[model samples]
Target: MSELTPLDKAEAAAKEAATDTVAVQLALAAVELAKAATAQQPAHSPACSHQHKPGRSTGEWLAIGCAVCVGGVGIAFASIAIAIGGISVAILAVVLRSLWRDYQRDVQKGR
Candidate 1:
């Protein structure tokens, strides 16, 4: 690689300084533009002046309550149905087991 002379080093430093100056000027211009844009806008817009209620209305609350009650009743009925189905399966298994035992006993007796 060729060694840089004093003149070449000075030129390189000047070029870097010019680039940094241009970047700073661009940043200041952007900041001024943002300030001017905000100055032209109203502090409180018309939409922001209106009153707002964050909570739900009475009718909405009543509807939600009714939905919860209906869901609870539906769950209770489903639980009852599942319990009845399980009991029915258990009774069937017991009856089949008793029949199988009687059949084995008869076979052993030569019936």
Candidate 2:
């Protein structure tokens, strides 16, 4: 998955807002709000649909972070060890889950 940093998010938000119609903008904003409320997250980043496009999931992100940290500490302590192999596959699982969940949620919401 492409890494989405604050800079990338801000740029995308600006670009999307520039072209959005009034109703589309409001709907997108509402979706963002709903997502934030569902996650019980603060408005760290602005709620933009572009940022919510088909992407990774929490599990995949957790796994990747764990693997990276493990690899770093392991290499530092021992000679070398790649315990977490198939990084791409694991990450793909997250992407698939995120897409399917979003689709299901949309269907339930009658969107």
CA RMSD of all predictions? 8.6, 38.6
TM-scores, all candidates, are 0.59, 0.24
Q: Deviation in angstroms for 35 in model 2? A: 99
Candidate with best TM-score = 1
Write down the lDDT of every candidate, Cα atoms only: 0.95, 0.83
Q: Worst 10-residue stretch by lDDT in candidate 1?
A: 44-53
- What lDDT tens digits, residue by residue, belong to model 1 across residues 1-111? 599999999999998898779787898899999999999998877866678879998999999999999999999999999999999999999999999999999999999
- What tens-digit string does per-residue lDDT give for candidate 2 at 34-57? 988879865476756465567789
